[model samples]
Target: MGRLRVASYNVHSCIGIDRRFAPERIAEALLDIDANVVALQELGWHHRGLSNFDQFAYLEKMTGYHVIQGPTKFHARAHYGNAILMREAAHTHQLMDLSWPLHIPRGCILAHTHWKGEPLVVINVHLGLTPWDRRRQLKQLVHEIQSHRNSHVVLMGDFNNWKPASVMFKPLSQLLPECTDQPTFHTRKAHAPLDRIYLSPGLRFDTIKVWHTPITAKASDHLPIVADISF
Candidate 1:
C-alpha cells in the first residue's frame, strides 16, 4: 500500500478575492498545498495584455509539475476550463465533455496514472451551476465511473454543490464516499462546501482538509481541498 496527496482548486481564472489577477499567488498557494496531484478548474488561457493569459504554462513552470489541459471552451485566442497537474507522469489521459446545451461549456479530465506501482484513475471536473444541469452531469459522471470500476478512482473538483446534504449528490455518494466536508467557497469567509473530493471503494483517505492560509484565502474565490489517501 502507498499514500497519495491530492488537491482540488477552482482558481476563478486566477482572479483573487482582492480583485487582482496574479497567477504567481495561485502558484504559491499550490506550493503550500504540496499535493502529489492537483485538479484545477476555471483556468484561463488568453492572449497577451490579459492577466496571466497563459496560466497553464506558467503554473506548470512555477510548480515544476506535469500539466494537462482539459479546456471546455475554446475561443479564437483563448481557452477556459479544467486542468490537472501531477508530480508523476500520467500513463494516459483524456478530456470528457460534460457540456449541456444552453449552458456554458463544462468538462472533466480522466487520467490514468499510478502511485508506488498501484494503478489509479483520477477524474477532475467542474460541474455546472444549475441543479438540472448538475443532475444530468452527475448521471453522466456516474456512468463513466461505473465503466472504470476495476481501477481505484479519485474524483475531485468544484462540484458547485451549495447544499452539502442535497439529494442530487446521492448517486456520487453511493458510488464513492465524499471525502471532505469543510466549506471552501467565497474565500472571504468560506461557508459553502462547493469544493469536494470523492474516493472509490478500497481507497482510504487518512486525512482531508480545506487548505486555508493567508495566501490561499485570497488566491481565488474558492479555497483548495487537500487529502492524503492510501490504497
Candidate 2:
C-alpha cells in the first residue's frame, strides 16, 4: 500500500525513426508505463528558436499530469533540456541551469509535489558527456539535494557514463541507492546503459523496469527507465 511509479526518459528531442518529431508517441510511452512521475531529457520547448512547441502541454493533456520544463540553452533555432511530469499538481518548481565547462548547456528541474498529502521533490537532470564535466555536475546536483536535506528526493536522468563504476556516481551514491535492478538505454542494439534512476534513503523501490517496446526503441537512442517506490 506504499508505492509510487517513476520513470526517466531521453526523448531525443521527440524525434522518432520515422524521421519526424512527435510528442504523442512520448505520451503513449508514458501511458504504457503508468508511472506516477516522470523525468524527461532532451525535450524541446521552442520550435524554431522563437516559438514554444506544446511539448509539455501535449504530454500533460494526454496523461493528465502537471509539467515543468528546465531549459539549458535558448538559441534562435530552439530551446532544449529536461522536464518533470507528475500525476499530482506541483505546488512549486525550480529550474536549475547546470551548464558547466561544456559548451552544451545541461540542466535539472526540481519539482515539489504533494502526493497523497506527502511532500516529494523530484529532480530531473541530464549530465554532460565528458567525465570531468559529469563529475562536476554530479557534485553540484548532490549539493543541490543537500540544500534540502529534509525533503524526500528522487533523481533520475541520463548520466551518459558507460562504465558502471565511476567517480561521477560517487556524489549520488553517498545519498541514494542506485536502482540497478535493470539495464536502461540502447534498445536499438544494447549500445550501453546510459540512463539511471537514483532514489534517496527515504524512498524504497517497489518495481523497476526498462521500457523497450518496439515503438519506444524507435522513439530514441535510449530506452526509458521506470521505478515504482514507496516511502
Candidate 3:
C-alpha cells in the first residue's frame, strides 16, 4: 500500500472578487494545499495582461511540478481547458472530448503517473451547466473510466451539482466511493456544493475535507475541495 495527497480546484478563469484577474493569487491558494497531484479546471489563456504567462505553466513553475494541459477550446492564441500538475513526471496521459450537442464545450483530462513505483490515475473534468449537457458528458466520462477498470482512479473537478440526486453524479456512484458531497459554490453565500473528489475502492481514503478558504470568499465563485488518501 502507498499514500498520496491529491486536490481538485477550479480557478474560475483566474478572476478574483475585486473583479481583477490574478493568476498569482490562484497559485498562492494552490501552494497552501501542497498536494502531490492537482487537477485544475476553468483555466484561460491569452488574456491581455496575462500575455507572457500561461496559467497552467506558471502554476507548475511556481510549484515545481510537471504539468499536462488538455485544451477544450481554442480562442486566438488562447487555449481554455483543464490541467493536471504532478510531483512526478506523467508516465502517460489521455484527453477526451465530450462536446456533445447544445453544450458548452466540455472535456476530461486523464494523467497516469508513477510515484515511488506506484501507479495512479488522476482525472480532471469541468462538467456542463445544463442538465442534458451534464448527463451526456457524464456518460462519456463513465465510458472512459470503465475502459481502465483495473487501475486506481481518483476523479476530481467542478461538477456543478446543486442537488443531491443530480443526474451528473449518478454514473460515478457505480465506480467510485462517495467521499464528500457538500456545497462548494457561490463563495459569498456558499449554498451549493459543486466541487468533488471521488476515489476507487482499490484505494484507501484517510480523510476528506472541503477547503472553504478565506480567500475563497473573495477569490472565486466556488471554493476548492481537498482529499487525502492512502492505498
Candidate 4:
C-alpha cells in the first residue's frame, strides 16, 4: 500500500463532550479522519441504554470497515471494550484478555491485515485508569504485542496515562520507539494525552496530528489522533 492513514479514538461510549449520547456524531468524526485503520475505545456491547442497538455493528456499517471487538467485562450492560476497524476485510483477528486481579477487567483486540501484501498487526487497547492497575496492564500489553505474528506492529487506543513521562510505558517504548505525546482527552480543552498510537520501526509515519475540529470537539470527550504512515 502507499501511505496509509491510521487513527486512534476514544468514543466515550458514543457520548460527546456535551454529555449527550449520539453514535452518529462519532461516525461523522470517523469519516472526517478518513483513516484506513482505526483503533476505538469505550464501545459498549449490551449496555442498558444501548441494549437495543449493537454498537459494534452500527459503527462497522457507518465506516464500512471490518470490526473486531473485545469486551472487557459484563456489567449492568457492557462495561465497554476496545475495537479495531480495518479499511478492508481482516486476514485474522484475536482478543487477548488483559484483566488483572481485583481490577475492572480490560482487554486488547488484535487485528491482522495487509498493506501492499505485507502483514500488519494492529493492537487496540483501553488501559486501566488507575496508575497501579495501569502498570500491570502495560506489562501484559508488552507480552501480547510480542505474541503477534506480524512485524509491522501498530498499537493504539486509550492509555489513560496522565503523566507524559510515566515509567509504566518503558517496556512498550523499547519496541514502538515513538512516544505517544499528543494530547487527545477533553476534546474542548485538549489537556491530556490519554489516547495515543505507536508504530514499529518498519512503519514510518509521514504526518501525525490530532483531528481537532468544531464537530469533533463535541463528538466525543476525546479527540481522534491520525497518522499517515509509509512502509
How does each model score on TM-score?
0.94, 0.89, 0.90, 0.92
lDDT of 1 by residue, 147-215 (tens): 888788999999888875689888888889756888998888889989998999888889988889989
RMSD of each: 2.0, 2.5, 2.3, 2.0
Go through the candidates in order and give each one's C-alpha lDDT.
Answer: 0.87, 0.78, 0.77, 0.81
Error of 2 at 40 (Å): 0.6
Q: Over the stretch 1-231, how does candidate 3's per-residue lDDT look in tens digits?
A: 245888887877788767778877778788888788888888875453354357777777777878898878776666778888887778899998988666678889999876556667789988888887788888888888887787888899888677646556767777886556767777777777688888877776687766766665666667787777876
Model 2 Cα lDDT, one tens digit per residue, 117-226: 66678888898888877888888898899987777888888888876566568667888765553566566576666888887787787777788896797877678988
Q: What's the distance in Å from true for residue 173, model 3? A: 0.4
**What lDDT, from 0 to 1, does candidate 2 have?**
0.78
Candidate 4 off by > 4 Å: 45-49, 74-76, 148-150
Lowest lDDT 10-residue stretch of candidate 4: 44-53
Candidate with more favorable, higher TM-score: 1 or 4: 1
Q: Residue 42 of candidate 4: its Cα lDDT? A: 82
Question: Worst lDDT window (10 residues) for model 2?
Answer: 45-54
Best lDDT goes to which candidate? 1
Q: Which stretches of candidate 1 lie above 4 Å from their native place?
A: 45-52
lDDT of 1: 0.87
